[model samples]
Target: MKNKLIKMLVGIGLVMGLAACGGGGEDTASGGTDSAHADAEKIYNQKCSSCHGDNLKGGMGPELTAVGANYSQDEIADIIQNGQGAMPAGLISGDDLDKVAEWLATKK
Candidate 1:
């Protein structure tokens, strides 16, 4: 009886371990896309929204709700970095720039 109980406990532990490992950490393993997107949206809201509008539908700047359909990620980054038309340059930079560019690229 003692041996049987021990074996059963071990089996249960093994099963639990396997289940834990199989979880795949989906929230942490999705190539950082989720967090990056959230960050990008936050940044846009804080910095870009004044000109781009709260919804990217254009305020002082042109409409960008579907900018991804018209521009690639690099192109968008370039525009943000260098400024285009009435928009000023360097609103965001470094990793924030990359994250925002990548997130915006998915808008299409």
Candidate 2:
């Protein structure tokens, strides 16, 4: 009886451990995409909205509604990092630069 109880507890622990580990992989994969978009939106609201408009409708900066149609991802990223005519350079950097560029590319 003692041996049987010990085996049962070990089995339960193994099953619980496996279940916990299995769920995290899937959640992390999906969560990355969600997190990137959320981060992008946050960054946009904080830095770009002042000039670009809250909805990309054009404020001090021009309307960005169809910016994706006009520029490629690399081009946009470059413009962001290097700055264009009246715009300043490097408003965002690192992973944020990539995320914001990707998110804006979907604006079309």
Q: What is the TM-score of each candidate against the true structure?
A: 0.69, 0.69
lDDT of 2: 0.70
Show pairs that collide, candidate 2: none
RMSD list, candidates in order: 21.1, 20.7
Clashes of each: 0, 0
Candidates' C-alpha lDDT: 0.70, 0.70
Residue 71 error, candidate 2, Å: 0.6
lDDT of 1: 0.70
**Leading candidate by lDDT:** 2
Per-residue lDDT tens digits for candidate 2, residues 12-61, read 45433433443111112455777777777777776676667888897666
**Model 1, range 4-87, lDDT digits (tens) per residue?**
677556644543343344322112345566776877787776667666678889765678889999999999999988877656
Q: Which residue runs of candidate 2 sit more than 4 Å off their true CA positions? A: 1-30
Off by over 4 Å in 1: 1-31
